[model samples]
Target: MKALTTYIISQTKLPEVSVKNTIELLNEDCTIPFISRYRKERTGNLDEVQIGDIVKFKEQFEALEKRKIAILKALEEQGVLTPELKQKIEATLDLTTLEDLYLPYKKSRKTKAETARQHGLEPLAKIIMSQNANDVESIAFKYVKGEIASVEDALEGARHIISEWINERTDIRNNIRQQLERFAMISTKVVKTKADDENAQKFRDYFDWEESLSRIPSHRLLAILRAESEGFIKTKIQIDDDKALDKIESRIIRSNNECSEQIQIAIQDAYKRLLLPSLSNEALQIAKTKADESAISVFAKNLKQLLLGSPLGEKRILAIDPGFRSGCKLVCLDAQGGLLYNETIYPHPPQNDSMGAIKKISSLTEAYKIEAIAIGNGTASRETEAIIRKIHFKNEIQVFVVSEAGASIYSASKIARDEFPNYDVTVRGSVSIGRRLQDPLAELVKIDAKSIGVGQYQHDVDQTKLKKELDVVVESCVNAVGVNINTASASLLSYVSGIGPKLAENMVSYRDENGAFTSRNDIKKVPRLGGKAFEQGAAFLRIKEAKNPLDDSAVHPERYDLVKQMAKDLGKSVQDLIGNAETLKKIDLKKYCTESVGLPTLQDIIKELEKPGLDIREQAKVFTFNQNIKKINDLHEGQLLPGIVNNITNFGCFVDVGIKESGLIHVSNLSDGFVKDVNEHVSLHQQIIVKVLEVDVPRKRIQLKLHT
Candidate 1:
């Protein structure tokens, strides 16, 4: 544990006390969100990202320790566990060095070296390697007895043994790795047989491409690997061969003799046949892991932003899944997102029933008392929005066009089926659209993070690593915003600090059987919810109708007595002290400090008391698309239009300009000068105006520049 603390501190460049305390909390099975929010003083007020870095390094330290144990046990079994070697292994923190020390002991199939050793050629190998024996032919002829038929055969056998020795030398191996790191080029060439195939056009840009392995971007690397996987291109990694061999020979060949010549042959053979293949693979794997981490980091950031998007709180909605020939599917939802009525309406071409659709929609709005209308931004979304705006409602109603990227996946999911067992997929999809407007975080948690469609090369990256990162992002976002116990679905509840899928399911089932919880204490009655679970999750779960107002706030139940004492000292009731800033200011936070609680925690409590359970996100607003542009063909050079920033990448952002194909706003056009990050100028779902630079109608691509 102490060693882990030291390693984490070095890796994160964090305070030693903070790293030590965080590791202890993690050792106690406390989660990232819990430690970040509840134990602010213990963790020195570290945010989720900093605590996350500690967790990452802690896991790495454990993995390294596990590998060390396995290596030690292997050495013990092989009877090569020297005290000096054990000390060396124990002192090293690097995995590469540790593995290099263990390389010679690795058991392998019968290679040429082992075959030559079995034929009694080791003495001949040593004699030639000594470089003192100038008569190498006589030295080789002395060993031409058992499998050696001639001096030439003896020389080849000795060279094979020398090659293995060269391969195992640590200095030579390290030198090759250094060269590969600095000078290797990753190149790809198109497979001549598949060049003209129609399916190969997607990877045409990668054909005959070459770039430095150390300098290529993560997305480009993933794309090239994908093209290679699809059999459209062949990839290679190489450096200057002459430089590498000269470096190796300078280290091995000391004297200019026939023995030096033999060592030269062995060095060349070791480099090409053994070192290059093995080390090149190791270098590529390192590069791939780096690329995966980069890609996964981008994906995690995008997922966090998308999940925390603005919400239109608790409005009765009428939502439509728009279409042309299939007839739009419409559903009415109450304030709590429960479906009240569902039907089909066609207001576009092939049906051309705008008047009839308007009459039905107006009557439904009056019948259901709908306050807002949510239209899915799918096929015919703009046309449907126009038709709905043409109708005048008796009451004021706002219209919203929500992105329906993963609605179909959610509609066909098992969770959807469980939620709406009596309804078909289209009705379920429409309800999802309505619910998304009410709360994007809640609706998005039900779908897989990867399917939410805000990542770069999500599928091409490591699936296990990507899923783990996205889950952490989701959990962090969920706990950061908090959840309404009565209103939150099982999926949302599952992301709360200690409440996993099973406990969330149990809580929901208990809610269905009983009634709404009235206090924080009532949560303990749920099955499988014990002390630790409550401690980790209770503050993040709100009860709006509880008798104690603090239950509705983020103030934990354990601090209720302290807070009551604070109010008592101020000669006021707890309810009166809540949100009373002047009264809250009168109390000295130092008076409440104890061994377990410090000023950081007290400051957090004071902040929570000031604005209890206040949402950290903004409210969703209505947006309108350009009336003149319907598709790519309608767009031309220098035309200004309104668009929404849909997806962000390292290079630029994609803007939806009321068309099927979104336009690309390259990073160069995002600012007047240098643009370090695309998110600094644009965010996910940001409404902005752009000027069209060019349009390729046949290819369905639009290039735009930021209007600002």
Candidate 2:
């Protein structure tokens, strides 16, 4: 256990006390958000990302230790547990090196060497490897008995054993591993049958592609692997043959005698038949894992940004799921995103009922007291926006074109069906678009993160890892922006600290059975929400206008007494101290520090008191697209247009310029100089003006550059 703590400390370079305390908290079943947010003193004030690193390295260390124990047991059972070997195995830090150490002892598939050994040819193999005999055939002739009918058979069998010996040499295997890691090239060629297949066109870029395995971009590698998996291409990893062989020959051969020649032959056989294939595949897998991590990191970052997108804050919205022939599905949502009215409007070419649509929209807006209009950025979206803007509304309403990426998926989901039992999929989808404009985090949590459509190669990467990573991002985002307990949906509450789907369901059921929770203490009366859950989650759930003012703040219930004491010392009531910035700044944080509470915790309490339940997110703003450009044909080179960045990838960002096809601003065109990160220039849902660099109508692809 101490070793595990030390290993994590070394890996993360975090403070020794911090890592140890975090591990202790994790073992006590505390969550990352809880430890980082509430237990600041115990964790030395480490943030969520830093504590996440500690957890990651701790798990890795525990896994490696488990494997070490198993290997030691195996060695003891095999009666080969020498003190030196035992010490080496115990000290091994990585799985690959430990496996290499255990390779010779591990039971392997039946091979040429095992057959040679069974035939009593081991002595001959040893004699040939000695490199002392000038005429090895005479020495080999002596073993030509008992299933070895001739000298040639004996020599061949001896060479097979020597090959196995070379294969088992740890040093030689490690050397080959190094060579493969440093110099291997991954090459792919299209399968002849798939060369002309229609489905193969998407992967044409990867066909006949070759690049350094170490330098290939994560997206490109994932694409190549996906193409190979779909049987469109064949891939191989290789290094310089002569360079690798020369190193192996130099390591194994000392003299040019018959015995040396036999040793050389064995070396060749060992390398070509064993080391190259095994190590090359290992290198490929290592590269693939790295690529998966890079891709997943990109995905997780984008998801964080998308979930933290600016919210329009409690507003009645008129939303439209835009279409042409099918007509626009319209839904009016109240401030809390409850659907109040639904209708269909035909304002496009197929049914030009512009006047009727305008009158209906105006009437609905007025009836619902709508504060904003959200139009889905889909087919006929620009035309719908134009029509809406032209409406002579009686109120000042902001119009926004929301990204419709996963709206359909959310609409057809079981959660949606449950939420609106009497509504159709069209109504549900329009509601999603509207609710997203209201609160993206709450609405996005209802859909699977992968389906949100922000990641490249999201589907092709490791599904389990991607899901785990995205879930963490969602949980982090959810806790960062505390939930409104009175109005939060079960989907939104599930991500709160220590409140999973089951408990979230229970809380919602309790809330529904009763009227509403008035205080943090009231949550304790709910079924199955025990002391631990409340401790971990109470600070993140806000009840507006609660009798106890502290219930609406992020200050934990356990700290309520401590804060009350502070207020009493200052001769003021708890409510008086809340949001009293003048008084909060005057209190000395160090005077409140105790054994359990430190300066960090006191400081956080002061911040929370400064503005109780203040939202950390920015407010959403309305964006306007170029009304002249409704399709790709309207785009021209060097045309300046306003656009919103809908998707960000490692390579660049994709901007929705109010067209059917999104435009790509490759990383090179992001700035006049070098561009290290795409987010530095643009973010999801950010409105920016861009200059069109090129447009290919044949391919329906438009290239863009950032407009200063």
Candidate 3:
């Protein structure tokens, strides 16, 4: 118990308040969301992930402590537990090391050790190990009983016992493993099989390559291991066997010539039979596990970057999902993403007349004040853009071809179908593509984030762990953006703090039964959303109209009264005081600060009021460039190209420059200065201008540069 607590303390490095609060909340069976909200002061405002990690680690420690106690009790019952052994076991920090130390006392498989013990040759084995045997044959012959009739038989039986003794020494094995791991090289070669001896189709590139164990990249190691497992390659590591034997003899066996030779053979035999299999498998597993960890980390990082990518804010947009067979499905939405009009037009079809498409565009733009057109970049997307560009309207509206990677997924989803029951799937997809440009957070929540395609090695990583981590990232992003209570569907609302499927359904039902909720107070009237749920969720829920003006602001409704009092103290109405530049310029927030409203809290309130729920979406910057580049070969070195960052990986960022392919800006070319993490340099969907550095059309590779 003491060791468990110490490990937790050492590993977390969490403040005392956080440690105590996490333990207490975990003890109370409170969920991560509940603790993050209701017990913020106790946990020092630890976020959900930190709380979850602490809980998981603490649970592991408790389980290990229970197992440790059980092991001690079992050994005591067996009457073989010495005080020194007990103390050593208690002091062991890692469970793996402790179990290795106790391997001799644990149950054994049907092995040479058990067979030798049955033949009563263990005493002779120990005597030989003592190395006082001036005559080695004479010493072993003494243990020759009925079963062990000859010196050769007795010696053979004794070797088995000695090998077990060597294998049981945890300290020796641990040392040898460390040495081999550092000194060995993993070599992989294509298998020379009768099926395809010279061809080596699967492992052609890796037919002859060797990497030092310590220097091998995780991905490369996994690739080789997988290739070998599939029978496409042969892989093995070469170690200094003589060095290993010498080390084992120095540590365990006595320094006598005859005993040393026998012990060396025994150690070598044990290594081949026991240690090699265990250590090699362990090394490979470690390599694979590290690779998986790296893959998971990259995926999680990419997911977070994608989920939190800047939204485009609210804007009047005309969305069009282009198709050759079905024609084009057009949907118009206002600044708030409420569907205003929907229709289908065949611009490039049997009719082939531009008049029909022009008339539809002009009517929609005039009727809905369409400021921009978000066309899906699918089949006929460019052709659709060309048709729209020729049309004449009152205002000059910009046209953008959206990625539309997961638009169909969102359109076919249950949430999308629920939201737009009257519309066809194509119409729904058009609306999704348009709304994604308007507010990515509100629209993207309907689709699985994985389908959005901003992950690295996602398919190969642990799917369960990857899903859990990505789901958490999605939830954090959703809550951080703050969903619109009225327009948000149940799927979106479920991501809100303290709201799940049932409560979200109840909320939608209540909203439907009773019009849009105008204030945070109305949430309590929803069925099953009691006081505790309200207390946890009310802060994040915003209302356009409320008695207390701060409710419309990001300032939680719980702090509404205090903000109102401060406004009143300054002889100003709460509404006029918050966003009013003239009044806000005159009033200093420091004058109204109290014990509850520290400098941090006061500054946050001031900032919140300055821009209440300020959307972090970047305004789309329109660029007009020459449509001259069609193929990769038409590019020249140092040619400036406008592109959008499609994805960012550890090595580089992929930029889509309106071509058939994407170009890579290696980590080296990201900037003139050294870069550690890619996100710090570039993020998802960021429109950047880069210069082409190299292009290999045969390999379909393009190297780009962001630096001038």
TM-scores, each model vs. reference: 0.97, 0.96, 0.84
- Give the Å error, residue 305, model 3: 2.7
Candidate 1, clashing residue pairs?
A: none
TM accuracy, model 1: 0.97
Residue pairs clashing, model 2: none
Better of 1 and 3 by TM-score: 1
Residue range 655-702, candidate 2, lDDT tens digits: 999888999999998999988888898888788899999999987889
lDDT (tens digit, per residue) of candidate 1 on 317-389: 9999999999999999999999999999878889899988999999999999999999999999989988998
* Candidate 3 C-alpha lDDT tens digits along 1-708: 345446666777877657776787677555576566445667777877788778767876776677779888888888989999998888776776777767788865789878888999888788778776667888877877788889988877888888888887887788777876788778877666723754445456677888887778655666676667667888887677778777777787657577777777788887777776677667666666777777666666776666665556677999999877678889999988889999888887665756888898899898999999988877777678778878877898888878787888988888888888988778888998898777677777778877887755566566776777677777777766677788787877887777877999999999999999978888999998887667667766776656666666667666678678777877877887767766666767678666545555566667787788666545666643336676688787989988888877667889887766789999899988998888888888787889999998876889999954
What are the runs in model 2 whose C-alpha is more than 4 Å off? Answer: 142-150
Identify the runs in model 3 with alpha carbons over 4 angstroms from their true place.
1-6, 12-14, 22-92, 98-124, 134-161, 191-207, 217-239, 323-329, 333-369, 378-380, 411-428, 580-597, 623-626
Q: Clashes in candidate 3: how many?
A: 0
